[model samples]
Target: MPDRHVTRSGDDYAEAFSLLLPQGQAWPRDEGSTLMKVVRGLSQIWGVVETSASKLLEIESDPRITIDLLPDWERNWGLPDPCYKEPLTIDDRQRALVQRMTIEGAQSREFFISAAAYIGYSITITEYRPFMVGLDRCGDSRVYGDGTEPMYSDTFVVGSIPVCNPNGDPVALDELSEWPNYGLGPDTIRHYWTVHVHQARLTWFRCSGGQCGVDPHLRIGLATDLECLLRRWKPAHTEIIFDYSGLTPGDPMAGTP
Candidate 1:
């Protein structure tokens, strides 16, 4: 187990405390408030970051993986308009990897890395909200107002599918020429709809974790832990303060620090 201690005193402390307050509201003085209890529970779990990082480090002596916190449009499937066709499918191995990493205890470094890769891919796919339009074409039919008008379309909408390679160079989509034939006219149109539907499915899997019964918070927490580990593994010059020196208890709306 790594250092299960969270350094309190600055922004880290303030931010954690802030989580207890409602948006635009100040932290309540009463310690018995429900929000305070929730905050306390979260604070206790701050050790989770250390525990997770330790597990990851154990699996890989030099555990360092690059994650695009701010992926570009091309990397994220060109959201709002993808160029590929076909739904992205997570292989059985990858699904299992996510499950293992999301478990309540320490997990393999491979599992953590795979889960991060999948999450990175999923995040990119989810950015393109139009994927659902493509899925609607292949699945059931639907109607809007009065349930009379059919929303089905002959052409399939297309989007990007993220492919996580063994080398860690995950791509949103493969070569456009490699897409499967959907028996639809014009390769371009088919590609368009496939990308759209694929993104929608990927989004769902990312959010639901593919029925692995893993809590969303766990995944998010693990990711955060991994990021911290990576940063420490490879020293950087970034300056991040954990200080909360002048913060006072008052309504945030009133501009109280």
Candidate 2:
């Protein structure tokens, strides 16, 4: 019979409570000691209790008071203004999932759809504008606009097609490419795209048609357009899994270890 050996990395037992350690500091040498193990176990239990309590408290707590309790690092990590953030990516499938998972009163479904569409529009335009215009005329058109209004107006030109409506069906690029002056000069396609994204963002986050109400904490601005804040649309702090992991120690959560 062949010999078999089982091995476990220290990270295998790690829990969210472990984040209590300070950043850049190593776990104590006694970290694996019996007492420390008990502490770790208790910390994990406390974390679950804490999370439940927070959710319950959130129902009645003043948002401002709750905001005050967040760690300074989380508060300061990204751009201060929502208007400058990039749009979140839009995926109908993901939005459906969000609807199923969250309470209906939260209206998370609409939020997901709007955020995704907004971000997807931003990314698509940011990346494909040069290709759509060809490299030569790319610099001729304005890349970034002052955060006042959408770059493209309703009548903005994109070859033979006039982008008459920001929320209309997407124009086919093949048809656009066949136009006589297709890539010869600067065009307003990028601006039109921004308008589409802006509309989505506004629908999701705005409390009133022209006023702010809901606090979108996860949204961070990469830049801005006229009346729209561009934000990264993806979920914040999602962990990407990598192969060959037994256990990997992560950064500490709080004060020095």
Candidate 3:
């Protein structure tokens, strides 16, 4: 399997991770087919990134940076926005529709590149270098870079889905105004949201930790275990620490070395 590993270290912490994709996953020959891959990747990637990064703001959709690569056919019919709080249910027909749309969107160079950047960046603020093609390099290209399939060597299968506590209802946007700032009790800041992916055909967990509606320390442990669980399928970079030795106002929560 073709794979790469990333390691990050700073004052308070140090960790290593990797992303494993099957070796040389080929692109489909048909133009339409390729586009479908893009769509699926986009939706799955968006769903995951949004759920993982929601602690920054209480909003489900961040207007500043978001991408959807749905095809015209699917778009015309109307597509459901991926929401953290909402459960996604699709019948066989709806599943097929989404599958087709995802493939088409994946094939589009602009969409693919943009989605990659967004997901990669959202993973962590830590510096990461994944095998990515820049948009400028793909400028004006009617088709994707040569019909060659990207090489991938490793894959991970999610063993089980994370179960959220039913008692924890989703925090609505309207409630944000009344929501306490500064810091609410750990229980109030933390909640679990699950995301289901079609390609991997797996359900994964996102534990809100660190200023979460729950306990920060518990969140860190869950996040760590989640990363370890993902390692069962593929290599992934996790737990990034920022270096601020020279800065006057360092992260107080980061802890002293």
Q: State each model's CA lDDT, in order.
A: 0.32, 0.32, 0.26
Over 98-174, each residue of candidate 2 has an lDDT whose tens digit, in order, gives: 32234233212234334434333222221112235222242333222223222332223544332211223233322
TM-score of candidate 3 relative to the true fold: 0.13
Residue range 1-257, candidate 1, lDDT tens digits: 34334334333553567655576445564567666666666665555565555544443232122122112322333221121122222222233233334445322223434433443321111111232434435533322222222222224332333322222233223212122223434333322211011111122333312335532221211123224432342214332222123323323232100
Model 3 residue 163 CA deviation in Å:
45
Candidate 2's TM-score: 0.21
lDDT of 3 by residue, 119-195 (tens): 21112111122222331132221121222233111121233211111212222322211111112234322221121
Candidate 1 stretches with Cα past 4 Å from truth are 1-15, 19-26, 43-46, 58-257
Better of 1 and 3 by lDDT: 1
* Most TM-score-accurate candidate: 2
Top-down lDDT ranking: 2, 1, 3
Counted clashes in each candidate structure: 19, 21, 33
Which of the two, 1 or 3, has more TM-score?
Answer: 1
lDDT of 3 at 1: 14
